[model samples]
Target: MNHTDHLLIFEPEMAGHQPLYIRLLYHYLLENKPTLKVTFVVHPDINKRLVKEDGIKLQTVGNKINLVFLNETEISASLHNTLWIRAVNRWRLMKKYLKTTGANHGHFLYFDHIQFPLALRLPFLPEKKISGLLFQPPMLDFYGDEKNLKEVIRNYRKKWFYTLMLNNTALSFVYTLNPLFPSYARKHFTNGNKAYHLPDPSMFPTGDINLSDEDCALTKHVGENRKLFLLFGALTKRKGIFEVMEALKHLEPEYISQIAVVFAGKLEAGIRSTFLDKVDFYKQNNPNANLHVEDRFLSTNEIISLLQYCDIVLAPYHRYFVGSSGVLLWAVGAKKPVLTSNYGLLGYQVQKYHLGISIDTTKPKLIADAFRRYLNNPDDYERNTSGMERLHAESLPENFARIFFSKFL
Candidate 1:
């Protein structure tokens, strides 16, 4: 009930995929009817960068949430190290913090499965509750495609270790954004000490923003006359970047000329060369088909601007488990129709609500056809966007917080 009730959130990385959801959770807890105290145990790399003078600001939405950043060492010594070493290192760092904190009767929220082994090892304060928040699996099935046989074997071994770590957690809370992984999670947490299917926080919005004079000018400059199709988030192999590129290849040159694909976020090393090569080929072959790639990290406002101006959003993940996506949520908040792959729970939700079209990413023809349909039936796309907005309004962070707190706290 008190703000000092102590909720520790352990995460390996806070910047990219994790922070948005964590921020939503932080605000929700703070804004709850009976406020719950929360402390975020962030990775050292994230904390160092975020706590800097020009770092991310931690402000509660309604003065209901309080954020304390506890820094932990990175999972790897170097950026391009093996994931196994990183997982082990992250667990060690988190374990060190948990042992020193000495908090009693509070809650421990593990954001990733890699933190679970260390969390379970901690000597918790008597009556303390431990809850695991699983965003996705430790290793994705498609990741193996990007590696050699030996490397794939090594990855799977590490994945097995991570799976065991997850099994040892007190309660596993899966954020089901993709519908495909629920059964996998259910099977993993079969004993069921505590396991709940919580929707991803992307389903909720912070609130509407009124454009200022300068903001209007910038929006008009960046987006005016541009039929934007946004693919926000890290450009990686599993993200289905190649699939989207292939889809674009199938589009008629004239039809493609009318649209622009805007990609925002950092590029992953695994597929960087291949992705860039494809992008280069497309640019050379089709000068009229505009492909705007922002190689740098984007701030929140810039992302919001893209969401606002974009006619359609693309979430073409090739192989993914059902979990929430910040991009999808942002599109919903911005009232933009999404064209996503029918691979996970996100696709299920989109189809269920008629909020967007789900295509088979494996088939370039289907992906191109989906886009053609959207272009031809602009009214249908608008209707889908409106439906997404309504769905988002119904699943506000406050409402979702109630569900999370009721189940965990």
Candidate 2:
């Protein structure tokens, strides 16, 4: 239980990109950091799902990779379950784990949930060498000359939080997925030098990915000549599903005929009926629209298969979306182009890397116009080879691991 040459990775949630992030880090440690003893602390449900059902082969990797299942709710006790309560409870779990294992360093895979509590209570906590990966830093969302009262208050509050969190002597480093935020942080905050840019990993399954019958069937609908525009991952209204459908209405039949739109991944239960109804209505109106829906959870391999099959990746996120996206990285990894929102960090990256077109996704006409331009000459919008190479180099899973362990190693 007492190991000085050890690092503990604490993660609770398993949905969305959590599992992929953990797998990438875990496998990286096992392969590259052979001498480092690492312990992964996750929820009991994740233990049952990832270890037992998914067969990640952590057990086969010998004792170097320690799997510890700690139920997060146990730490919460009988406290009224607010966000602060939950954040504090998670922090308590991490502190206890660090104390129990005598780990030299601690890292949080997803720390945005617990950051405020940790910042406020770090003085009380005994841990000295702890770091966390921040996916969404509100400071990055602040555009110049804020006029809204509520927005100004929120921005100032975030600034205060960042000031406390970064200036704390206990924190070794705060890793960020926003590659551009580190410079801004260093210039603005007192101890912002600790802000390190951890590349958002874009790597996906390549070579011969085992495709299912359903996967094969999904690709068959794209036919021979038409370009496929794919909107992958969890389907929610915020993903601009309605905007896409409305945009399709603006395009001419000939334009719609040349392109196919596929809504892949599980539709949010709240909007499933509405989404299906829209799809049906679109089909009824434009018979040659060529729209397909794989309304369920897609495996990593299946997603990669789809990525390889598709022509353009649609990432028309809502205006409020400020964080980096896994979809953008997947598009880059696949050497494909994306039509994303020109609002926040996503817009900055697409424009910086020349990944594809960035526009105001709120307007259906803009989305339609982007499609028309791409359809006119797909080669004109294709991501450059150098751009893809640079993005890939920066976003490799190995870089994510290296930067994460920079303080410890």
Candidate 3:
């Protein structure tokens, strides 16, 4: 192996949702196969931050990895103007970058969903060896309580463009987190020659964080004897934060006293009002109860510490379209018992692996009862921990490296 073949990872923005997985993938590739040159093709806005803060650099990792910061002229032209227009312009810019890069480099792997506007615009470029890796299907619809016609139409349009782009790919790999997504992708794309099913990378544990005793100390003052049920993710309605708060209201006072709920994540702008309203209502109704909400992002060490102390992890997600979540992966990595809803692939994994208890998001009592069951039965909690440990051991970095190399590398 000459170690000169390059992998080009294209992501518009390197913040929120996808970056975590991308970071994991970057490290996995570098550590597992040191010879291959990995070049991250990010938009100008993302490149600086990803390099400085996110630590996505070749030399930093003590390897000869390359990070190419391709300036997106089209995105810069339409940003702060209109999203639809911006997407169109971004597609043009991305196509230009791909064409120039592809001509210079003989072979490259694109680590993005098949539907990015740029992928659709790829017809303009000369044919070259390009592999498309799908983390999530672009056309998958997210169903929730919000029923605005305009929003619905916007989502459908976005999906339509994605479908077109994915169908035209040279080589494609669908990383299905849920069974439903793969079937949906296969049917919609209908490109058997290019597509294959790949599992979500989140299932593979990266590594264990070395947390000091002081670092693991609870954010809120914990009395000598107390139990805590923690929920950590973006505090949005779709994430079931409101439902969790409602469930807490019905719990008995004694149980409430023994329990504390810690919410750690940034709240989405649209749902900030709803989130605050629920928090206010909960506090007004139960003055003595402990409800700790950390509204900012936490460092990896902080997150690991919080996970270590959690009695039970709560992931009462309302949407079924999303296949896997980094939050759930973290809980599994930390060996904490999770109380997640029967949503999509995550629910399937929970049931199949016996990782934790699953509840219906519609029923608040189910969530409360599930929490109580784990709180009351120490043996059940222990059993769940054992299962999580086994799962973790089987799906760590080394195991994931083997799978990736065997299939793709």
Candidate 4:
């Protein structure tokens, strides 16, 4: 690893769970390959989740990585909603960054975000070697107001459409974070050795999580005789949080007092108010409902601590959610099992990894039945911890970085 190879991870626009994985991978590459000169081009605006130091410590080493923040690569109030404009601005910034770094003919570039309409198709940039991690393929998306008939047609067209889309890109390799991506989606990439399935390692909980499980207020609800089941992360209808809460109400009274359910994460104002009303109803009828809510986004330390506190993570996701669940993986990282959806990528990953129980989350009775099952024998799900360490080893940020650069470059 010399001047002959340079790895550039272009991540100027942070969105979704990118911040969580970016932080994990950044620290991994930093610790594992200290001498490797990697350039990290980040967004000018600082996000604490992406770059925060616990206490007053500075996370950046300032030597291995050349942090180039573009001042003009941003969208303001008037035209901020337009994706095309912002993407183009970031695109312009990327070209400028390559020039500024004096990147040579065969340097490696990884774009954390997938570009659109005018996508980040690097075939045009032949001088530099390229690799990208696709967080969402077109097949993972469903259009607005699409009817059931049209949706069926779209699902059929999407695999072919995605295959063609990636086939045309001149990238040396394109990796999908989801290993369960429809096999037919890429006839060549899967079979021709062009596309790789990089199991997403985005769920690494922040530092020393197991050390402070007793320090968090959330865990206090999990008494010696009680088991804790958590519905963590942002609250939304798509995540099946409402249905989960409703299911909690239907839990048998004996089970209700024995199991504590927590919904923790930032809730939109309307959702928060409605959630409180529902909780109030439960409280008025019987405190045995035992539901607690921590309605705010969690910090890195808090997230890890919360996961450690949780006995079982609930990811009863909507079947329509095509991608994987960060919450489910976070639980896996904490060596906990999940109660999740039985359809789509989330379920596939859960089953593939043997991480938890898959349930038809759309039905409240099914959810309640699943909860009863988990309570009957939590150890059944806990047995899946054997593969997690190996999964993390392969998915370590530096390992992913090494696999692409060492093999391709």
Candidate 1 regions exceeding 4 Å error are 1-5, 28-37, 44-56, 59-84, 104-112, 115-129, 137-190, 203-208, 212-226, 379-386
The collision pairs in model 2 are none
Better of 1 and 2 by TM-score: 2
lDDT, candidate 1, at 132: 54
Against the reference, the lDDT scores of all candidates come to 0.59, 0.77, 0.59, 0.61
**Which scores greater on TM-score, model 2 or model 4?**
2
Best by lDDT: 2
Lowest lDDT block of 10, candidate 2: 72-81
Q: Candidate 1 or 2, higher lDDT? A: 2
Q: How would you encode candidate 4's per-residue C-alpha lDDT over 1-409 as one tens digit per residue?
A: 1233555666644334654545555666666664556666665553554444233221456666556554552423112446556545555555566667865322212332323422334334546545566654545333222335655675655545445545544445666666644353454333325556766654564455444553375677666777888887878777788888788778888888788888877775557788788877887787666778887666556767667767788888776676656776677677778888877676666777788888778888888888887788766664366766555555555555455445433
| Candidate 2 residue-wise lDDT, 1-409, digit = tens | 1233788888776555766677777877877855778888875565344453235644425767888876546633413247777777767777788888777777788777656865695443554477888887767344322235765676677778878887766677788888777888988888889888888887564456676775466787786789999998888888899999999999998899898899988798779999899999989988887999988766566677778899999999986666789989888888889998886788887877899888889899999999999998887674777887788778887777776655565
TM-score of 4: 0.74
Clashes of each: 11, 0, 0, 0
Model 1 lDDT per residue over 59-116, tens place: 5344334444543224333121765455455545545555555432233333454453
The true-versus-predicted C-alpha distance at residue 125 of model 1, in Å, is 9.8
lDDT for predicted candidate 2 compared with the true structure:
0.77
Residue 71, model 4: Cα distance from true site in angstroms: 5.1
User: Considering TM-score, which of the candidate structures 3 and 4 is the better prediction for this target?
Assistant: 4
The top-ranked prediction according to TM-score is 2
